[model samples]
Target chain A: MPVLYGSYRSRATRNLWLAGEIGLELELRQVWQAYRLDKPDAPDAPFNTRSRGFLSLSPMGAIPVLVDGDLVLAESLAINLYLARRYGGDLGPRDEAENALMTQWTLFAATAMEGPGLAIQNVHTYGRADSEAGRGEIADKVEALGRPLRVLEGHLGRDGHMVGGRFTVADINVAEILRYAQSHEPLLAEYPAVDGWLRACQARPAFRAMWDRRAAEPMWL
Target chain B: MPVLYGSYRSRATRNLWLAGEIGLELELRQVWQAYRLDKPDAPDAPFNTRSRGFLSLSPMGAIPVLVDGDLVLAESLAINLYLARRYGGDLGPRDEAENALMTQWTLFAATAMEGPGLAIQNVHTYGRADSEAGRGEIADKVEALGRPLRVLEGHLGRDGHMVGGRFTVADINVAEILRYAQSHEPLLAEYPAVDGWLRACQARPAFRAMWDRRAAEPMWL
Candidate 1:
């Protein structure tokens, strides 16, 4: 059995969605869920990100650690990629070429989309998106995001999926980043294709199930 | 022969270093190089990041595209991973678990280290590292960088390589990130292990070769 360690509050939500898509049951260990009620700051509590046991598992001690037998892996993208490759039925790439594309989209999601997406989220979450200074900063990020979004728009506008005209890990990876843009209502206005593609991708039953489950998680704060 | 589109000016350097490490010859497409000498404003040229052909290769028009047979990948990390896996010989992972670690560290490098490392570079390139606001910003980035750097330090302190107790694609992915910090002298001071590990990794003939080749490339503006 493979164990995924992280809270949905973190980037672990992406993996949870992936597990849903692949119909795989993961033994989830939520550090935050445990921390909410348990002795989070206690020296021996395994729920703490800084716990000795966690450190032994990963040098980063960051959640979304997956311990599959002898392999203890951290980082959500890696875990998702592993799960897709190892257990994904149609979700995994068919060959080395497809594998390269999968890696490309995954890295793009990680590097380009997620970074600006997080900034927009941060600005919105902090109530700064409405201010003049915040708007300026938001404009810059949006402008920076424009290039990638345009790419997505042009591609998704013509094609249905990210690769091979089907739902794969690439769709999950890229769409998840766009989902973060929901708070910024106007951000998606320019990228109609991306917006439409995101809706279609999220319309999948697996995504619905994951969202429901995520909504059901108890918030610590 | 596989075509790796992009110059050392882009993330392609990472893949070139891997090619050097594994003794693989890649068709290096120096688009930006030709831009400086040939037609700087060619509309259909593949050299232009915004050209129609380059956009056809990549939606985002980002560089370091790897065209291996039928596969066209745009991200540098993805290209490096594919190269290592497909043609790596001893440089690739040995098993499924090792593959997971390779993905993990590669994502870690792509997501964690590159962002701040680029910011640090921007500060240095603009000669802002010495200003008050610049110092404050530098302090913030360095502090934010502390977590991942410390993670690298603790792990490198114990293990010489990132995985399997030997050199693999994971080491190349990570060591490249730390190399950016070389410009920041005091940054590596606290993490003596990471410093030593980086020095040892960079001392490899392959890395030296890549650096020499990069030094020889013509800069365009």
Candidate 2:
């Protein structure tokens, strides 16, 4: 079994979601972010990204590191990509072209959407929406996000999925990244296709299972 | 031959570098960013990102779109990974584990380093370093970049390569992203191992060939 280090509230949620989809069991070791804990440096505190053990696994101190056999991987999306390609039946790429296409969509989500999505998510999650400056930042981030969202909206209009005309890891990765902005209902409403596609993706039993576990986990931030 | 869109001046330069390494000949098409043109709306304007043909290829209007056979893939790193997997002998992943590791490094470069690297590069290239505000922005970006660079420095300190203890697409992808910040000598000097690794990567004859082509290209920014 693969050893996954991170709490469900962390980026590890996506990996768990994919694991649920494939029924691949992972030895999940809960790790938190130091900034999220009140007493992260305390000796009794749980293993976190700042912990020496976790740092040795990934120097960047990122969550969602997957240790499958000898292959230790980081980055939530990258982990999912590897998992899907390795253990996922039809959930993975079926050919070289599909592999390239899936990689393209994954990178697109990471580079083009994740930043603005996180910014927008932070504004809502951290109570920044109550402040004028925070609201202004959200507006700016939403505008910055419009271009890529429009592209996704256009692509989703066809076949209603990211790649292979089916729900592969591509859809899961992109949908999760886009989920950061899901709180802004009005923004998502602007793209009906994207809205519908995202809903379908989240409606999956695996995603619901993951979300339930995530909601049950303690959120420090 | 694969049809590669974008000029030698665009992100296509990296793909060209990888192609030089693997001896894969691609049909290079000259496409510029509309923002780079003096009068983008002019009918006589060259085929650029805004052109219907280019947009049809990639709706995001991104350059460096690769059309290998039937695969129309965006993202420079994704294209290189595909090319390397298909044609690169030792330059590509030899197995699934190597594939996952390479993908992780590529995403790390894209999501972690590219933003600050580009910020620092723009500050230098656009002559923003002449002003206090620009210099401050450069300093801030350099600081933001240090964490990921430190991780990379530690990794490169291992076997002088990204994965498999040899140069692969991982090295190419990371080296290209780091090249954006290479103009800042003082910043790179802090990570001696990173600096040494990047130097060796750039010193390759394939990179030199690509650099020569890029130098001869017209610049708008």
Candidate 3:
């Protein structure tokens, strides 16, 4: 059985969404966010990703560390790609070209989408969600989002999936990042195709199951 | 022949370096930095990454856009990973476990090292390598670099490679990111193991060939 360290509230949601898509039974080791470092940590709160033990497993201290037998993977996106490839399902890319597409979109999500999207999410959820600072942050995130969204707008509808038609981990990987825009209605309004594609992806039963599970579980302390 | 757009001066160096290692014949379409949008046309000025043609192939207008057969890919790390896996020699990961390590380091390079290292590079090359701002940026990048370098200090040197006990594109993918620190003497000195690993990897003939090829070309305008 594979164990994924870090809570759903963290980027681990990316992997949870993949596990749902692949139907993998993952032992989720919920982890505290790094912000917890400022406050006193509970003696034994599930598992702190900041702890020495977890850091030993994942030196980056960022979470969704997946332990599959002998292999240990840290990055959430990397873990998803690995699971998709190892499980040998429809989740993985079909060929070299498709695999290239997979890498392309995954890196795009990481570099282009994830940073700004998370900034928006963090501002909205914890920081000033609608204050001047928050609005400024949202605007910056939205502006940062445009270049990549236009890129997606160009290539996305090539059979309603990112690569080789139909859904693959590429879809799940990229969609999860863009899903951050859902909370910012105006941002979503700007990119209709992105909005449509993200909606289509989120509507999938796998995504619904994962979202519902995330809603029910209090993974973050 | 796979054609890689964008020049060695851009992140395309990562992919070009990989091509050199894999012995893949990549038709190099040397591209210019996007910031050159302010400059006038030099009829035959190396194609700028920001050009409409490049963006049509890559929505983000970044490079190098790799064209192999029917597939096109952008994002430097992604292009390298795709090439490594597709043109499998020792360049790619050997098994499921090794694949996970490959993904881990690549993402680490992207998320952890690349941004700060590049920020430091920008400050050093363009901003102020010795100014207060330069010192601050260097401090920030060095601080940002500590975790990942510590991690590499732990995992690297399994018989002189990142994964599977030998040199792979994972080495090329990651070492290339860490290579940015070479210019910052003190930063490089702090992490001796990282410095050692980077030097060992850089000393390879493949890296030498790519570096030489890059030096001989006048891609920047």
Q: Highest TM-score, which number?
A: 2
Residue A183's lDDT within candidate 1 is: 69
Model 3, B124-161: lDDT tens per residue? 67859879878987888889888887778767633457
Q: What is the lDDT of residue A112 in candidate 1?
A: 77
Chain A TM-scores of each predicted structure, in the order given, are: 0.90, 0.97, 0.91
* Residue range A140-209, candidate 1, lDDT tens digits: 8788787778777888889878877888888988888767766678888887888888888889898888
lDDT of 3: 0.78
Alpha-carbon error at A99 in model 1, in Å? 1.0
Model 2 collision count? 0
Once superposed on the true structure, which residue ranges of model 1 sit more than 4 Å away at CA? A33-46, B33-46
Pairing residues by index, what is the TM-score of model 2? Answer: 0.98
Q: Is candidate 1 or candidate 3 better by lDDT?
A: 1
DockQ of each: 0.84, 0.86, 0.75
Candidates in descending DockQ order: 2, 1, 3
Per-candidate Cα lDDT values, in order, are 0.80, 0.90, 0.78
Best candidate, DockQ: 2
Candidate 2 vs candidate 3, lDDT winner: 2
A best-first ranking of the candidates according to their TM-score comes to: 2, 1, 3
**Poorly placed runs, candidate 2 (over 4 Å):** none
Better model by DockQ: candidate 1 vs candidate 3: 1
Please provide, for model 3 over A1-221, each residue's C-alpha lDDT reduced to its tens digit, 9 standing for 90 to 100: 99988876778888888888788999987777766544425665546766777777777678878988877788888888888887748779777677777877898888878788888887877858868989988988889888888778777645567877778889888988887766777886766777788888889888888888778866334
